[model samples]
Target: MAKYSRIIAQAGCHIHHAEPAQVYEAWTNPELMKTWMFLSGESRESEAKADVTEGGAWSVVNESQEETYRAYGEYLKIDPPERIEKTLVRKETGGQNEKIKVEINSILNGSQVIVTQDVVFLHHEQLHPKTVEEHLREQRRQTEKYWHEMFSLLSKQLTPS
Candidate 1:
């Protein structure tokens, strides 16, 4: 067994108009993920590839006028419409990687979804914000903002006009 100390960041949201299955699909489906996965509003995903089974590999590439970002990971666990655990490495950020666990629970008989994400950073010093507390707080804030935006986009995709 390996022992590691990590900084943990968590965020959650209740999606009013989507089911746990739909949420899981959006997260695991490459084509759907390309629509929203980054902070920059102008940035677009060039590639979003995933082998969505346990021990499978995944990668995503986002591009903007200024720069390009790439991330890759491997699934450690998967439970349909419920949970997934993976390790994600950001290539552009000097190979910094983290373990990401996501859970999607049904709230209203599959009509509403509750999504939660836990990100564990093994190399705390590599992350910005100076201290563990600051790093966790900043990561939480950013995760909340980004996930809200992503869910908003997913909502649009699920309920197109």
Candidate 2:
């Protein structure tokens, strides 16, 4: 038996008034990350630890959540304010087993972040034979809407002479 899972989602925002650098900064910056990714008002804080070099380690920590996700992967490709690609995996899950690659691109008037997640089921035998396809689809829909709202807020703050 084989185990496989794939989910692709496309979400973008148009900050016609802000430069790509500004949008990119907001995307990668730790402060901005907490603002959007964590909303529990738990005083979420993160240390960038972003070398952003071709081959470097990137890490982030969420104190409030009491969780940490880190990765060590080479920058497959990077075009300033344009695109970024990397191979990553979840820590503390287990021994190195699965790999996830994420690519983000900057689009006209703003940027587009597309996530392609591939996961391998552990102990594929014992798992039930049920798939949450519709549930995942719904989740993607809600997430797209959420991004739209966040981008709207960013635009309001960014748009100015």
Candidate 3:
């Protein structure tokens, strides 16, 4: 078989202070999403809207100190507090098209959220597996960092004053 691209980046964490449903809501609820959505370290969300149903549309405007842009897509699958799969688009991705699958499961006293992005390759050239793996490792690390930051923000919002 010919390889067009190799893309697999995964990140997850166990938040012992939040429940599965609460963690899921952070991704499905537009309002909750706005609180943690970040384009950069100092960036914040300007707008977020989602229908939260299969085939429903979702969009977010991420504003950083340097720039602002919109990322929009549709929900491919939504399974309550267990899982969600959706398409995501960004300018730098070249509409490379990707499916972001978020899985939430109940843990000891909180929740575990795992996010995986399947990046679609645009170029039709065959790349070496080692090369692909190295690239994915860096991407995975960066993605994991972002998710952790987002979750931290969500946790703060869910905490009592």
Candidate 4:
């Protein structure tokens, strides 16, 4: 068996204008996911595909001028309007894989979305001289940035037309 460490990273944002169900739908719905999940300037030429039920799989590919990035995952648990647990694999560069848990809660009649990711570095030799804690902090920082951007876009999607 391979040894694994639970290097956890967490981030959260409050969506004042949307309900928990709307936030949950945005995450589970592939079409909605495609609109907000990629980097700031990348084009969403390809749509995301997802099986939102428990044990189902999902994938999304994003293309940029410099490179293409792919992310795929299997749903581990799905608690409607409340929580979702999944395993995600980034199929580019380092190919990092992680277990992700998302919780959507109603706060002051609005939604607060929290994401927790547990990751393992299988090959220590590949990392630089930086300590594991340092690397984890950097990963957490990057993860926070991505989620913050996605949530910003999600907020826009929930805005009134």
RMSD of 1: 4.5
Q: What is the lDDT of residue 64 in candidate 3?
A: 74
Lowest-lDDT window of 10 residues in candidate 4? 1-10
Alpha-carbon lDDT of model 3: 0.76
List candidate 1 stretches off by more than 4 Å: 1-5, 91-93, 109-132
Q: Is candidate 1 or candidate 3 better by TM-score?
A: 3
lDDT of 4 by residue, 1-161 (tens): 33333467788988887889999898889988888765457664646888998989988777777777777889999999999998888743155568889999999857899989886654455455456567667777877778888778887887565
Please provide, for model 3 over 1-161, each residue's C-alpha lDDT reduced to its tens digit, 9 standing for 90 to 100: 33345367777877777888888888888887777765456675477999999999998887877799777899999998899999998775676567899999988877888889875443324667677667666666766677787767776776555
Better of 2 and 3 by TM-score: 3
* lDDT sort, best first: 4, 3, 1, 2
CA lDDT, every prediction? 0.68, 0.51, 0.76, 0.78
Best by TM-score: 4
Per-model TM-score, in order, reads 0.75, 0.58, 0.81, 0.85
> Could you give candidate 2's per-residue lDDT for residues 52-149 as a string of tens digits?
66665555444557554343444555566766665545442233333333334556665454444333333344455454455446645764565566
Question: Candidates 2 and 4: which is better by TM-score?
Answer: 4
Q: In candidate 1, residue 150 scores what lDDT?
A: 69
User: TM-score ranking from best to worst?
Assistant: 4, 3, 1, 2
Clashing pairs in 4: none
Clashing pairs in 3: none
